[model samples]
Target: MNLRKISTNLKLPNYALAIAQDYLPSTFFQYDFKTSNQVRPAHTDIPKPNFQEYRRKPLENPNALSSESVDNRRAIMSLFSFVGGIGTLYGCKAHLVQYVLFLSPARDVLATASTSVSITDIPEGKTMIVKWRGKPIFITHRTQQVINTERAVNLADLRHPETDDQRVQRPEWLVIVGICTHLGCVPIPNAGNYPGGYFCPCHGSHFDGSGRTRKGPAPTNMEIPTYKFLDDNTLFIG
Candidate 1:
């Protein structure tokens, strides 16, 4: 068939023609419909923000305070800081003072001498053992016969040759360390072969009324410690 006859014979609707034009290839049409549908992006070159300058400038605020008000606020903060520092220092000073008062050395109490006994507590011819500085002390109230017996002892024959008078400040009160001269054993009072004296049962060491070693393996006299009469009756010992 010829072109005019084909065109007249094929009775296409207006909607059909429109649909065919939309599906036509880009080569048949000079311009692409898709390109015409796309909007060109605006060439807007937004200037880069000066972040350093923006940070340096203070932020704008309608309710911003005055410079005088800001300075007053800073002064208040400084006063609070100073007060807090002073309070901390005062607390430390209080703790230091308490430590010094409660924990300081106790040398004076330890070094002072101790009181021993009153004379009324001990009777005539009786002996008492007391502790002083962790050792036994013998405080004897001697009779006249005991004093005479001690004085009559021959110095040449005695193991420890101290005179009876030298061993005592007062002849009636004889004070000596109760430990045996030989083996450091505490001696029994008024129970030995020697009269009015101490006796060590462990080694049979005997001490006279003057605390002189009379017999057995003892080498020296019983030790005498420093003591003084506090008054007529009281005694102080170290």
Candidate 2:
């Protein structure tokens, strides 16, 4: 219906012109589309219906809850969520603690891991042997004469030289592993060529009172296990 000619003939704003371009009919029609504030005159032959007859009636909802009931439901849901989150956290913590404990050593193995001896049981100038982790540990109760003799020895004469003071925390107590340095053989206490020392009969290795390698095939002194004095009368060895 010559829509372009109609649009070009009419004077309209940019926005209104664009709308007329899209919505304008391809064929001529009787309807008038006005973009102005002026109202169109109503035809006398067409009658208007009463709005009251066409209006919808408001209906009452049978299942609608009050504000108090809605608030109570919301509060209950929030409390349930909080309780569930707290329970999950505690459950994870409990599992983590149980896993950590499962990885640790058994109680009986830990008990046998270290050895404790009463130094008062061993008389002066005597040595006592105890077992630690399936190995013999020598606990010597040195006399004043034995201590003096060990401290007086020359460091140059020993194979693996270590001073008597360096090997012991206290002069009266000498703690060492009883295994021979030459080979894995147990040494006899107070029966070596060096008096007041240990003798390994397996390889003829001699160790002085301080556990230093003397005249033998042994290359180093006897090993000193990890030890500490729990008290004046107790020795703890590991």
Best of the candidates, TM-score: 2
> What digit string (tens of lDDT, one per residue) describes model 2 on residues 1-238?
2444445456556677668658866454334444477867779757866565553232133245455366666777899999999999999999999999999889998999987888888998898889998899999998888899999999888888899999999999999998998879999999877768999999898998899999789899999999999999999887
TM-score of each: 0.54, 0.56
Colliding residue pairs in candidate 2: none
Model 2: which ten-residue window has the lowest total lDDT?
Answer: 55-64
Backbone clashes under 3 angstroms, per model: 0, 0
Indicate the worst ten consecutive residues by lDDT in candidate 1.
53-62
lDDT score of model 1?
0.80
**Residue-level lDDT tens digits of model 1 in 2-83:** 3233323456566655665678553544432231456666667656555564432333442465673666667778999999
Output candidate 1 Cα RMSD.
Answer: 15.8
